[model samples]
Target chain A: MSINRNENSKLDFLLEIGNIGSGNALTSLAEFIDRRVDMKAPRLEFVDFNELFGSVGGVENVVSGFLINVHGDVNGIMLFLLQNELASEVCDILLGSKLIDLNALDELHVSLFKEIANIMAGSYISALAEMTGLKITTSVPDLAIDMAGAILSVPLIHFENVFGQILLIQNSFSVDLKEYNSSIFFFLEDESIAKLMKQFGIE
Target chain B: MGKKILIVDDAAFMRMMIKNGLTQNGFTDIFEAGDGQQALDMYQAERPDLVFMDITMPNVDGIQALKNIKAFDPAAKVVMCSAMGQEAMVVEAIESGALDFIVKPFKIDRVLQTVSKVLG
Candidate 1:
């Protein structure tokens, strides 16, 4: 749980990268939703999969969800959560109509979240790629309705430290009218971690 | 001549955001729509030279609206607006005949640049 001096530096690098990525994501969200979003970069932590799951009190229901699976020399995931009202507001903004119904889960809602996630994650990964000189490609974002638990329950087994455990990076953000929370949970294989450390000039 | 632009998105805040970007860049006579259905109706009525459209909504989506507009105006100049992680849909929009795409949390510079390019 406690990172050493060298590891601390590496974490700092990741945090800085995450900060830029989050900033890019926030800017995109603001434009798309037409609302100002307050974004915060939380203190970075390294936790085993079990500890991560236990710390967050598990995933909860959300109005809209955007998730991107990041793959490359450095591996992890980026997730964006939006409250239903906010999601409807975003849908309204995007479609150019006030007719968006915020109360229901429908195909339109799912597609909107997928689009938001795509833009946010794409902007984040592009920023990261620029910083690290790495090529990153994300999977086609999957849409879900009231499926946070289903998505979180499925374990990510990429990291060797906790095979089948989910290592989570929890972060928070808020839009003008509503508050939102999101996380990036991934298991990095030892090789990936080693490469990440070396890239950060920690090795 | 300055291009006539359509702003479609349900949120007033968002409509204002795109309107600000366009007006600041000297794009006047901008029109607005709240949903995909309205967007289609507006396309038929006003037939603006350009559109900055959001991808998600209640009655219809940006993609569907984009397709509908394109179906009506094969020469329609439509730009898809999306938040993060909607790359695939963006691609679909482009293939469906959108002139280009813009990602949101709108950057003044990015929006201006995309508009200038499309107009040019």
Candidate 2:
């Protein structure tokens, strides 16, 4: 049973998984920060690299990004992006003081953000792994505080040989009362997509 | 409440949080390591009563450190700590001689409870 990637059913299935993963990640983040982390429905987009960067307020948008290379049954790159101000706000909550600037985040601040990304992405990846009965793990994660375009190019370039269009799951979340937008891009190899679809009996 | 404990994590913030919790609960003989290599070295050097080690880290990870510590002393009481989605690694840790597992974003009470049970 070969699954058609463009089929509406396939899109719906991936979106559902995205929703579940984001929900679990949000719950974990809320607990970690002790704040009300609310989320909007997850959106799944299969778009060109240029359009992908545009989705996150264009590639020039200055943001904090965390990149993790996912391994095991699911082979892909997982990226978490956060607005600079929102990154600082979360750091403030974690550090119990004001984070002067995201651009000037010191070693401690970098470690804190990396840990937060670990909790969030780990929870989300765990949900997917549990649901599919696949063994999944992530690298230690690399952080980039730069323009969205510059940060996103890392994953896009890494998966360039495997994918023409990337699967992006956009999540909108708010911490405390400040609205923040974040995105998670899952660059699954073709075989990985097939494996996931087969797990759900879609193929 | 004099049980010596070691906290291993790459994040200074995480180590500080766990240390603060353990200290507030009266567990004073505590040590910290930034990565698994440090964890293994510190475990042999400090001989802490119990260790709370995060699973993912640079250079060496928690599971490897657990294996190293156990090989040195099978009677070592070690607990693996990780984020929500690391069940596979958690199982591996337990199989490798870890006494328990703790998830991140953990409450202070949970950390204390695990310490009490493991040290007891």
Candidate 3:
């Protein structure tokens, strides 16, 4: 099953999986909201660490995220982030109710948010695993309801010592026939990339 | 008590979510475990009518736990919770005698449907 891959070819392969994953995510989200969900083509980018904060509002912007650890033939962290309002909107639809203001994240909010991220990422990676013909698996997600910078900082450890740009998929999701747009992000390491290719005898 | 159910996952939050979903559907006779080791022990202690087991975990994972439980009690009704829709893994679980599987980010109705079909 090995296919020869240059750096560009490798990323192309991964991005293909990203496309499938994002499509799965959008479908799952559409089902959850019981509304139409649309997504623009996911963009692959390499952003500087310091400037990464600006892509999603900023480091100080309040956000909610789901953190998943990829295991097996490939190993890295996959993250899904959404703006605060959209996250709450999703929760409202999922629970079939709206809640009043809350400056703090309570147990219930975190739980619902985690499940949303769980299904989204679970479907994403599951599709990726199927596409790659590798034994890729994911652990239970860890959630963060905090400032964007704070959330990104924790996973930064997984990226430590690696210089240059951080690679990611920037996906835009439009939910429920509304023009309101949201986002989901993913991060996989170069080592994982190599491992995945190696499994298919692509050394 | 109603039909006893056991949920096995590494995350307390997920365990709570599934439990809440089950309770909302009037299936509240439930027990929880953090990982496969605890799940196996609880399976013996609780002898739940059916089990919902997550595939990935810190300690003894779901596959090993499923094997252990099936080995211990051949009649154990076990269903796997798979994060990825991996064909090989699904095949392995089925080979290990899993009754069925449900993917994560579950809809409550889907969960209940799986439960009822398995219980029947």
Best by TM-score: 2
Q: For candidate 1, write residues A1-203 as lDDT tens digits.
A: 65677666666766676667767867776766667777776534566654654555445654355556667555656555455566666656666554355445455555556667766777777676666555555655655545455455444343334443233445577776467666655444556566756765667
> Candidate 1: misplaced stretches above 4 Å?
A2-6, A41-43, A58-64, A92-104, A157-167, B1-120
lDDT of 1 by residue, B1-120 (tens): 567888997655567667887787787888999889999999899989888887655578788999899889899988887552344555678899987777655567877788778877
Q: What lDDT score goes with residue A95 in model 1? A: 62
* Candidate closest to the true structure, highest lDDT: 2
TM (chain A), candidate 3: 0.82
Score candidate 2 by DockQ.
Answer: 0.72
Under CAPRI classification, how is model 2 graded? Answer: medium
| Model 1 chain B: lowest-lDDT 10 consecutive positions | B82-91
DockQ of 3: 0.47
lDDT for residue A60 in candidate 2, whole number 0-100: 84
lDDT of 2 by residue, A120-161 (tens): 888988899888888888888799999988998887766677
Candidate 3 residue lDDT tens string, A11-53: 5666676677778977776765577777788776545566567
lDDT of 3 at B116: 87
Alpha-carbon error at B44 in model 1, in Å?
25
Q: Which 10 successive residues of model 3 chain A have the least lDDT summed?
A: A1-10
Provide the lowest-lDDT 10-residue window in model 2 chain B.
B84-93
Alpha-carbon RMSD, candidate 2? 2.4
lDDT of each: 0.65, 0.83, 0.74
Every candidate's TM-score, chain A alone = 0.75, 0.91, 0.82
